[model samples]
Target: MSKIMSAPTLHHFSSLFTLFIVLLHHSNADVGTASRYSPPYLPSGCYGTEATQFPSSNLFAAAGDGIWDNGAACGRQYLVRCISAEQPRTCIPDQSIQIKIVDYAATAVSPASAGGTTMVLSDKAFGTIANMSATLINIELQQV
Candidate 1:
């Protein structure tokens, strides 16, 4: 006589098989597209002294030069292009500035404004160029 399987054993096997198939389906569903998440804050080439300055500091630091007077004003209009090292082809903005690039921090942390990019400026530079009181400035970077 052929051996027969018990009902309980058959039910257990069926349950295990169903679980395995469900797991397989779930794993397969995750393939293809990436999960949705917040887009990165794109870095730009046109950084501003307003975006990079700290209020408490006495001077602004240029990325390429030495420290500058915290109260100095730009003698003429200047332009810079903002580009991201992470995304070289992606240009954030294109524009010109009359203000000089001065010494300032590239990033800041505060209780009110926990995290953001930093740009330092002299009081005069800030007043002459932008109405922003926040440490960061929205600037456009143009290719020279």
Candidate 2:
């Protein structure tokens, strides 16, 4: 009789422990992502002026100081993906866009916002990937 009662209690404890582990794993799945920066977009960047025009279809980016030092980013291209957008309704999932590094961001651009900012992108690139009007969106970037 006592053995039977103890068996049920042990089973219940085991079930609770399993559930706690599952919940913990699920919650931590996206842990480090919050530290990642969502970059912003500019319609016309400082790279090209009115006299020297740039096409919007040409996806370009301004590398932040943290990523590239002393103009090393120029001429480099990257495979960039919009992982998430600020406005959930405007987000187009999993779109990847390639962009060239045409400019550079000042060191001040670091910690640009509380959310963080990794780079500045051209309007066409941002819109194509994010499919949103948001000024900033989370992205995954890889060198090409």
Candidate 3:
């Protein structure tokens, strides 16, 4: 009789444990692709040449369609890190940067980013986490 009672408790415990693991994984990060953009960061889709548009650190990005969210993503901050890339040794491990969304990739000039990338990071931000030679790289992002 005692064994039968324990079975249900054990099953409940397992279910709770699975839920905890899933939540933990999601809290860590989300994977996406990022490409780099050069100077002339002004005249952004969001700010449109505002005086204080660019961050002092120049750690900024232009949102792709997936993240653009119809202008709602403007000024949203994200913690980003390079995870992988097509070129070998493209990622610089143990490095991550916080970037602000200042524009939309679609409207940015100078080949803003690779087609279908999740975001177009500024040259400074891209160099911090990945090799500048890489046109696009996999990234781990967490909104903060």
In the order shown, what is each candidate's alpha-carbon RMSD? Answer: 18.5, 8.7, 3.4
In the range 48-129, model 1's lDDT, one tens digit per residue, is: 3344432233222222112223424222123432223232333234422333443222321212121233333343433333
Rank candidates, TM-score, best first: 3, 2, 1
lDDT of each: 0.32, 0.55, 0.91
Question: Among all windows of ten consecutive residues in candidate 1, which has the lowest summed lDDT?
Answer: 28-37
Output the worst ten-in-a-row residue range by lDDT, candidate 2.
28-37
Please provide, for model 3 over 58-92, each residue's C-alpha lDDT reduced to its tens digit, 9 standing for 90 to 100. 99999999899999999999999999998889999
In candidate 2 the C-alpha lDDT for residue 27 amounts to 24
Show pairs that collide, candidate 2.
none
| lDDT computed for candidate 1 | 0.32
* lDDT at position 42, candidate 1: 19
Model 3: weakest 10-residue lDDT segment is 1-10
Q: lDDT score, residue 89, model 2?
A: 54
Task: Give TM per candidate.
Answer: 0.25, 0.54, 0.82
Strongest candidate by TM-score: 3
